[model samples]
Target: MSIAIDFNHVVKKYGDQAVIPGLSIKVKEGEFFTLLGPSGCGKTTLLRMVAGFNSIEGGEIKFDEKVMNDVKPSKRNIGMVFQNYAIFPHLSVKKNIAFGLENRKTPKAEIERRVDEILRIVQIEKFKDRLPENLSGGQQQRVALARAIVINPDVLLMDEPLSNLDAKLRIELRNAIRKIQKEVGITTVYVTHDQEEAMAVSDRIAVMKDGYIQHAGTPQNIYHRPANLFVSSFIGRSNILNATLFATNDKTEIVIHDKHRVVLTNIRQELIKSTKTNVQVCVRPEEFLFTSDTNGLKGKVQRSSFLGLNTNYFIELESGETVEVIQESDIDTLIPEGSVVYLKLNQAKVNVFNEDGSVNLTEGVKNDAAGEVQSEVNNVAI
Candidate 1:
């Protein structure tokens, strides 16, 4: 039975040092939740707290309203998959998956029934008799996954389970893990530093920094309408530009490079009411378009690279700051280096942040750290 997980101002301490001060988040039943951030950001520390491997100093960690702070690892009934495959080298794939059930003293016939079913679920039936040494990296990871889920634990905890595999194998196994998790319908808490992997696998992601959650929402919400400048830069590639904001009644206008202008009506009303100016703008690589008209930000192309579906250009703006621009690969010749180009901003998609890069002033952005998740995924303007 899958269960909901909730953290209520949870705190973790290692002796005198408090790694996680107070963190709160929610994971719906059967939802794939990912904790993503750079190293030492406390993502792993929080995951350990959930698995009962770390001591909780304050607040509560609950699985469906049942406090888990004092629960032992063995009594928690959770399955863990680590970065390194922790399978027994001497045991065959079949034995590795059935080891848990055997320890519980399950019937021999029931063990065979469950083991055979899990082998098929992980698609490693042919290698059931093979030892861990004989299997490939991807296959060994599959064995680890099969072992973790065979017990039908209430929750599955995976900490960078694919980090040890090659790039191709990582992609393959990530997709496989997502598929298997969905098929089994187990609530999972996945931890990783890989943003792309997190976005690819999670139903929702909690971006963490310094033991605090910066933002928590669906992949689209985080990518298209981030809560702050830190989240904007972390989840994907973004070009941060300094600009001035001016408000006239209901409409807001932003000027870049003292020349190019963008008018918006959907800015947060509070910002307009307060007449906040001198802000930072976050424009994605694909949000800038080349235009023949003079009413745009002027830049000189420095270099261009063709990456099959999209071509990337490195351009130096009039202010001498370099920015990356991505456009669809066209049949025409590539924009040569040294060519002056006028770039137009997609006004609807560009995000504006306060001078400190702490709050997003764009309309429809929640800007809440530990508050409720975005109820609407398509909060960005169309």
Candidate 2:
């Protein structure tokens, strides 16, 4: 059966160092949730807390509806797949998979049936008699997974299970793991520092930084509507520019680098009302288009390189700041290095932020009328 996992105000400190501070999150029953962050950002620590391997300094962890603060690791009924694969070298695949069931003293016949069923599910039935040293890395990982799931634990925790495999094998095994998780309908919490892997497999992701959650949302939401400057820069590539806000009776205009001006039509009126007139603007690398017209900001192409699907250019603006732009590789007119070109930003693709780096603009709006309409809707809803 699936179970919900909850971390309520969890804090873990090692001696004088605090690894996780007041972390709180919920993983729904049968959901695939990931904790994504850089090394030492407490993602693994948080996963260990849920696995009952690490003790919390404060707050509570609950499985289903029961508080698990004092629950033994064995009694927590959770399966964990580690990065090292942890398969016993001396035991055959069949024995490794049935080890958990045997520890619970299941009948010999029942353990045999369950082991066979899991081996087939993981498509490793042909290797049932083989030892760990005889199988490939991917195959051994599958064996580890099969062993973890044979007991049918309420929750499954994986800590960078694909980090050891080659790139191609990593992709293959990642898809296989996601497929198995969906088929079994087990609540899962995966920890990884690879943003691409987290985005590809997680139902929802919590991006952590400095031992705290920076943002939490679906992959699409986190990528397109990041909550802060750190999230915008971390999840993907974005060009952040300093700007000054100039608000009129209806619209908010941002002056970039003292020369270029952009009208921000998506900012909330309440947020703009509190603005101190200076802000920052974030633009994704693909949002700018190169043109020959004299209307936009002029920049010299510092370097341009073809990278498979797209061409990447490092452009130096008139103010000496460098910005990156991505365009289709097959474009007829290429901006050569040292050539001056006009860079036009699509107003629809810009994100505005306050001085403190919080997102100030709602994602989409083309004009003041749309902003007013959204404001009215928000007011009515509230």
On TM-score, the candidate that comes out on top is 1
TM-score of 2: 0.90
lDDT of 1 at 77: 90
**Per-residue lDDT for 98-122 in model 1, tens only?**
9999988989999999999999999
Candidate 2 lDDT by residue in tens digits, 160-187 = 9999999999999998898889988999
RMSD of 1: 3.3
Write down the TM-score of every candidate: 0.95, 0.90
Number of the predicted model whose lDDT against the real structure is largest = 1
Against the reference, the lDDT scores of all candidates come to: 0.89, 0.83
Which TM-score value belongs to model 1? 0.95
